[model samples]
Target: MSTILVTGGTGTLGVPLVERLRALGHEVRVLSRRSPTHPVDLREGTGLDAAMAGAEVVVHCASAPRGGDDVAAGHLIRAARRSGTVTNVVYVSIVGVDVVPLGYYRTKLAVERLLEGSGLGFTILRTTQFHDLLARVVGAAAKLPVVPLPSGVRVQPIAVEEVADRLAELAVPTPAGRVPDLGGPEVRTLAQWGRVYLAATGGRRRVVPLPLAGKAYAGFRRGGNLAPGRAVGRITFEEFLARRDRTGA
Candidate 1:
């Protein structure tokens, strides 16, 4: 079994990715600021080398949407190179990071470039937004009597488990750079997703489409974030809602 280190092992995608790796019999180390055993903050690079020591593979799932992702990636790349033991680094990125002008997407794309030039073996997987995030967005809007959603904005929401599965498969000793994009089985607009949310939660709210002006919003409207041709994800938004209802998650 390969000895692997997973960053952001406590976050949304990190939690399941760590579990999946461990279940596969890999020696998995979770590198987190709050981790009891392997404690390290990616932003500060404190204690990172110790946590990364002897780790053959590193799955970088830790990310900050608000900012500082590039800084964290720089630290991770430096530490991985210093370790001299890390053979593969798997990074999870967003689908439209290259085209989208969002600040967060720009940060993600910057990190991708950092990894590309780091001289270490690496793999980058870009996927659509997660189902939970979409649910949260819809839920937050449902609080208002009239829910306002972006006009002409569509999203492909994929299950976190499916993403974790793909990440696990890519966490092998050998690195495969720039794998195929993973997207949801269906591409639906925010209005459609809001309706799905309202129907599933039995909430009564009038959904309104709001046209927003911004380069990022325009990119979204143009479907820059979509991978309709690579809709390999089997789980639909409705199925995700049903599963959440069943598990109360």
Candidate 2:
């Protein structure tokens, strides 16, 4: 059994991925900015050697959220190449990173390029929007009486659990370089999902459609970011919302 290292192993998806890998009898090591069993900072390039020592597979799931610097992912890819000890490197990226001109997506695309050029065996999984994103949108919209949604476009979001599973599966296989895009079983408009989220949360917020302008908004409105034919997730939006801790309460 090869030891696999997971960057950001304590994160939302990382937690479950680690647990699953551990159950499969693989030695699991985690890298994070704080309190990691094996503390390593990709940005600072510190403590990486100790964490990577003896690891055969490295699943690169660590990333900064929106508004934070994502160059760290690129740094981690460089570090993995320096290690030369790890085998497969699985990098988790978002779908439409090429089409979405957002800073966060742009950073991810750069990291993907870095991995491809690194000469290390790597697999790239570009997944659709996460189910949790819908919940976040609902929560943000609840702050105002009127929730504004883009009137013209649609989204094909996937479950984070499914994304995690795909990452785990790729860790053991040879680098399938740029695997097929993973999306949810259904497609829905932002307003439609917003309403479902509000109903599931028992919220009374009103959702108003808005005409979003600008290139980023147009990309989203034109469905440039969505991969409808790549649908693979089993969980529906309603199923995801209903499974929440306080659903219907």
Candidate 3:
């Protein structure tokens, strides 16, 4: 029964989130710089107030996926403060925001800080790497005679849909602060995950283990981004591949 404003509505997370909210009987409006004309670029602070006019919840999911000018969550926090009508600001963050050694992760952590100090009802749901990304990694790694696996890397990847559902749930309620980390049901090594993907795709490839060095590689190899004992997703990686197979893409 709440009207929710979803930023980055055309992006990976935003598209599905808006659909879920609309399906659940909530009035949904998508904020973007291009389509739908609600033009609120969190990085620039434009069109935010207009989008927030009647929104009770704002799901801020408009971060750069890989490359950008690097605006932290603090920017959105300031925009929310200016809107002054948002009841809860639910932020979509990665599971290793606190443990990973990457620039994007650092930005996420800084944004979390901004949310904590913004004095508004807020929630942060930390999730693992998306399943689609796993497919990409697997496709790339399986190209060689033997898959070069990162030793000791433990990952529990979740479907994007599951993460979106969790965000939708958080959007409708009062901020629960930092919620439980959402992860896939089972954990797998980097090589095993890659193999599963290749096998599912009916591709011929051998799996080989590789010891990755450096801080970022070490962090990933040491299970820095997974949450095994926390929130478990319903979809399995194999099941996800099966679905993709049905679509024949």
* Predicted model with the maximum TM-score: 1
Residues 22-83, candidate 1, lDDT per residue (tens digit)?
99999999988888898898889898999988999999999887899999999999999999
Please give the TM-score that candidate 2 achieves against the real structure: 0.93
Question: What lDDT tens digits, residue by residue, belong to model 3 across residues 1-249?
Answer: 998888778887788999999999998889878856576776776777777776778888888757442463565666677776777989888888788787878778877877888898899888888888888787788887877877788788898899898898898747789988888888898888887988898887778878868888878876889898874798998998999899874
> Model 2 clash tally?
0
Tell me, by lDDT, which candidate is best.
1
Which candidate would rank higher by TM-score, 1 or 3?
Answer: 1
Assess each prediction's global lDDT (C-alpha) against the native: 0.94, 0.81, 0.81
Error of 2 at 65 (Å): 2.9
Give the residue spans of candidate 3 off by over 4 A.
67-72
Candidate 2 whole-model C-alpha lDDT, 0 to 1: 0.81
Residue 217 error for model 3, in Å?
A: 1.8
| Model 1 ranges with Cα > 4 A deviation | none
In model 1, the worst 10-residue window by lDDT is 30-39
Using TM-score as the yardstick, the better of models 2 and 3 is: 2
Give the Cα error of residue 60 in candidate 1, in Å.
0.5
